[model samples]
Target: MKNRPFRERMGFALEGIRTGWRREASFRTQTMLAGCALLALLVLRPAPIWWGLVAVTCALVLALELLNSAMEAVIDLLHPGIHPSIKIAKDMLAGAVLTISAAALVVGVAMVVATGPAFLAEIGL
Candidate 1:
């Protein structure tokens, strides 16, 4: 796998994203939020650092969501029955998503706070 060509690896990665989009409502929802954040970045015209922060944070959140979904799918396939350990694993995955989401939210707010006034003045507000 490590020896696979970059293009092939990318295709596999994209397939994972497509699978996540199809099977995970949370992934779709997070993707939409990321899109909205990107749109805000475009409109607000924030500093370069804010752009990087928002992009990286959005990517991290989305990537984690995908990982969570994948892990849940595998767990379901392997364990098909309810067990305390499986339950805890799934719960922790959900918790990870929640934590990243909160961070993303902070980035969003800070972006707006740091750039909103400049954007408003630019619009003669």
Candidate 2:
């Protein structure tokens, strides 16, 4: 197939986002969590390295989720009925998501703890 123009490519990407946001609760929830993390980062304004770690962790979680969603869709299309191998594949993908999410949680918590009293003060709590 011929390569599409940049605008068309972006439109297709946006459509994917719209479809995922509408169809996948996990996607929507993760997106909200990421947004909150970003807001926290802005408020905390930690060291430069911490910013990079947090950004990468958030991106990794979101990207893994999109891949998992795509995998589930393809698997369902190919195997509508239950099958052991299909179940394993889906389970592994979910496991990968869980692993990354846990990593992201760790990064987020570490940042919060490292910020310590300043974080609490920043929130005026």
Lowest lDDT sum, 10 consecutive residues, model 1, at: 1-10
Q: Which candidate leads the pack in TM-score?
A: 1
> Once model 2 is optimally superposed onto the true structure by TM-score, how far is the C-alpha of residue 39 displaced, in angstroms?
2.1
72: Cα error in model 2, Å: 0.6
Off by over 4 Å in 1: none
| Tens-digit per-residue lDDT, 68-114, candidate 1 | 99899899999999999999999999999999999999999988998
Model 1 clashing residue pairs (backbone): none
